[model samples]
Target: MICSSSSSSSRLGWRGAVVVVAALVACRHGQRPMPAPFKLAVFPVQNASGGTAPIRPLTEALDAALGARGLEVVPRGNLDAVLAQHRMRFTGGVDRPMAKVLREELGVDAMLVPTLEQHVADAPPKIAMGVRLVGTGERPVVLWADAVARSGNDAPGLLARGLVTSSGELDRTVVAEVARRVEAYVSKGAAGDSCGDAGRFQPRRVFRAPVLDDVGRRSIAVLPFINDTPRRSASDVILGQFVAQLARSGSFEVLDPGFVREELLGHRIVLEGGVSVDNAMALLSLLNADLVLSGYVRQYVGGQGAPRVEFTAYVLDRRTQELVWSSSSLGEGNDGVFFFGAGRVHTASALSCRMVRGVVDHIVGRRGPLGPAD
Candidate 1:
């Protein structure tokens, strides 16, 4: 997940030129008062410094915010397939020139091209972004563009002490700016008639637990999360919160750490150090678990009366060793400063909880029967 920027390219031409002209003309003629809601796609932001950018979180946040504003967002996976088909290589941020190409190639109403200004993981990770909206030939105008920056401590201590941790506001700031632009574009008639045709402008919802039906209960093993952060205690802090939340959900019969360790010991699985995928599988089998969950706490800070935590998780299928569901979350608190930033102003517990829950629901609930309520 190195944060790298794509090499700059010459000004767009051919298809890019055509799209630009059509877009500007539509704006001038005012053929339609308002364009239809749009189908939007986002490419991952690149990090020039080889640092991991908050790619998924910021993208998800933008999707959620835009969805609230009545725009449709195509799923990232699907968007990737479309882009790959067109043989486009997206290196992190989307510059203006790249946006036009993506929009035309993908046949989408708009493409979000972001330029990565900063992607260092320092004490306060620096994750800055510049965004531009590129439209198709029917809507060539570059509807909007914006840039956002955030600084924080505990980024990840990369490339000397220069790259600290990621800032709490980094992802939020990018999402807000993108949301504002999307809203403005729709209001200014850049959206066009696409939205009117529901089939074209609809987001494909990843079905989670649509319903509870003749479901078979599956046991899950929640393994210890690796501490990828610079802080020594960061892993423990995030671990506590994760286990607590999973326990609260009561979705699966959770195997406590003690139980897992004991099982590992009996099977001579070497529990003295970090757990690998094979070790995790052995433990799962011994515990009679169906799935194994593991992740790493990428950043954590709690020295100056304020605490921050950032972590990621993955649900692995024991048999196939495939990552069925994976996600990342960051939580911060001014008052609670420690203990995983519980109950603080900057805490993302509610939102993070929803995200983790969504992953769980997707994995387990999907296997369950779809209910009428869902």
Candidate 2:
């Protein structure tokens, strides 16, 4: 009897040990591993400072900074070639749809969109820059963003003198600061409220009218916008941005602008004063489109330090010859700082992009004005 009891005790101990080992292994496997460093594609830095300044040095400086931070950056030449192959102009901005294309084509995990806020070669050499790191997926995310503003006199005499002589030094300093902020954001894994506050610098205005149920599935044609601003090219800039936003929404089948232009020319129909019912019907028949989008650039003013944009849009049903939807947006650029005279300026392109985004969002049934802190 004693021998049998001892054997039973030994077997129970072995069973308990096995259970404990299994539990330990399961625990180890349950923990998620840290993600690998992102394979990043740094797009060409957009020049939004309203000047003819060369942006090559700035782009190189940013690449070097990110490389030092252990990021694998796509080479500039390769990026440029891809852009050319796709017939894409580097507009210093990439909407969600474009980002998806870049991800699939370039095999990049994320894209870096940087804008030159201020790049002056004046005596004190002012420079400001903003950068956004966007993740690529079906739903794009703004993973990180930070802006840097600096004046030559902000640094010591030796450094300030170097900035005056070589803009490369200034670029490096700004890029380094941006890299530092981005690193901190990644390590924390949360942007917190402070990052949310940074969005206050730009505000968005959105308006929406009732849209037809089938608008989402219809093919759309964007006519040439009427240019009311002094700048002859303002209409072209706004039109390109508007089309890009509409395409990004994925709510409509946007027809090719070149095709639309050619068809309009063939019909001898100039949409200068808006589309007449008969003209609209004829054009729709020629293009076999479902809807027509027309807009007028009410305000597109850009100067040394201030840029503003305003536009109104209308959506007409091709079959009914009735206006189905209307939306308008207004935006102004401002440097985020006001107290110490250390603010960053916004460019005309940036303002127009914001306004177009607002209009698109409203048309897609997302009706709400973006707050300052959005």
Candidate 3:
């Protein structure tokens, strides 16, 4: 897949104000408006500029801009606490499933995700920034998106230009533009024709296995995924995402990973090298589960550019000791109409979420046996 940012003119100061005014006028003409007193959470801006520039300044700027527009902003401390409780980190992309979790945990109406595509502190400071507003709900919706690129006059040793140079000025301008767009979106209550384009970034299922007819409403135990990637925590991150996907699907009763891990540790069983049939059966019996879920992260690569993820998953019938279903999926961090300058982007966590959804949807299909797990 290919990822590209929306092309917006850097000189949007007057244009942004005009848009907001137009939206307010439309509201006066009987158009429904967004409800007042909405709360927003500005997630930590992601650094995808292929550099180590600080992100705190951008995040703080956005937060301040939103607050100045009369929108209630969630405190950074509270947001961080919720993320810590769920063991989640800000990674630029928040899928519908994860968005729902955030809504429940933080009670926020919307989330802002910003990505810094380029930030050069050279003579003529250059910056490219992208921002998206996502509504918190069962299925998150993209409320707005804006991207801008800016650069100052080229000159060697422009350090004499002082700290308040083109870079800082452009940053504030972009933040202000984002804030203006958000206000307009709120006042109009309509996301416009462009909203339909947001689907291009959504995760799509590429494959599906034959439905398992005999599993019925059985409890499932998801073992820790084996990580073949170089990242040491790939397994843990992917496993958590997979379990969350399964839980949200309501396909089978999912056993707690903590409980499953304790049992595995007690049995001195290491699942990194694949589980034998006998050992799988033993573990199934120990957990009193009907099916065992296992997987391997074949590839996981993340960086300043676009992150990519690949994994294979399988479901084994404990009673029959046979592999009932299996599927594999690959997700690219950037994929879409690159020519139009529009593409999906995924962070490591976001890619894992997409991969898990693909695997789970393949196994369970759209409508599966829906009932509380045993």
Candidate 4:
């Protein structure tokens, strides 16, 4: 009876020891799921050229990826109509204060930024995409990110189908990869490791001067260019062409020339010809323009008996009366008559178009208006 009792006690002790060891192993390996205080507002993917249209496909894909991961996505219809109605383009990182305004105004937690840098219509087509996770602040904290994806042709439609097939599935591949990475990060209880931090836009560094915090929206007016050409008709032609080009850039809220002239008649600036920079500034001040661009057609000569022409344009800062930008271009036409197209003016537009773009590049830097912030 004594031996039996001793054996029972020993067996009970061994069982207890095994249970404790199992509990320790479980404690070492098991992990608690990450908390859900984080929310992301994915930005529309910006194209390499910085146009918004080309990124539509990528935006859809990213939305689906985030959705599958149970991350809430702002609906496209909600913001798309708003931006279009307002004619507002999402200004890159330099608009953080503006974005923070948006966060408070729109009630979003974080901003997810994805950019499509390159899209080549190769055999399967290649898509280069980057994703960034940023928090809400005047300067947002970049929390997490994923690598760029090189996908094939069908990648374009990955977001639409909500699933990918085996053949050339770039979008699907990227979305799946991003979800896996984010999930792993959440599992590890890590935060603030951004995937392509260098490229993200931070507004503070981009703007040359302090921007108005949530400035009330204002309209704009575009005045005609003064023509100094020998031909009287040259002035009208140049100014008309300038107006059309500026409209295409989507930068200015060009007031109707006819309306401006009629309004100016009330103020006495419009004479038989256009107004000078002094009067133009007065007119712009009355019109409440943030900036005014006034310039003259310094030279316009169709090459003698040749299909070529020389054109020179100058821009004046309406307030300071300084030459902001100036450009001269010469082009050759086949008919030996100088039109806006041909030599020097490589783009497809009137000579005035080149001048307009040149001035814009100069004002914004040689990198162009939509370039990434320094």
- Which regions in candidate 2 have their CA more than 4 angstroms from the true location? 1-209, 335-345, 366-374
Clashes of each: 37, 0, 4, 12
lDDT of 1 by residue, 130-169 (tens): 4554444321223334444444543324554643344555
Q: Show model 3 residue runs off by greater than 4 Å.
A: 1-211, 366-369, 372-374
Candidates in order, TM-scores: namely 0.35, 0.47, 0.47, 0.36
- Provide the global lDDT of candidate 4 against the true structure: 0.42
Give one digit per residue, the lDDT tens place, for model 4 in 1-374: 01101111111133323433443344456634224334446667655422233466666777787778876666767656544665546522213343444465555554665545334443443444444444444333233444443434222344545333232365566556666655554334333222222111111111222221112211234456665666343444444444433333333333334335544656777634544667756766665554444445554443222223334444444445444444554443232325632232211122333344344333334221111111
Off by over 4 Å in 4: 1-33, 49-54, 81-88, 151-168, 182-374
- Listing every candidate in turn, what is its Cα RMSD in Å to the true structure after a full C-alpha superposition? 21.6, 15.0, 13.3, 21.6
Ten-residue region with minimum lDDT total, candidate 1: 1-10
Instruction: Please say which candidate is ahead in TM-score: 2 or 4.
Output: 2
Give the candidates in order of lDDT, highest first. Answer: 3, 2, 1, 4
User: Which of the two, 2 or 3, has more lDDT?
Assistant: 3
lDDT of 1 at 97: 36
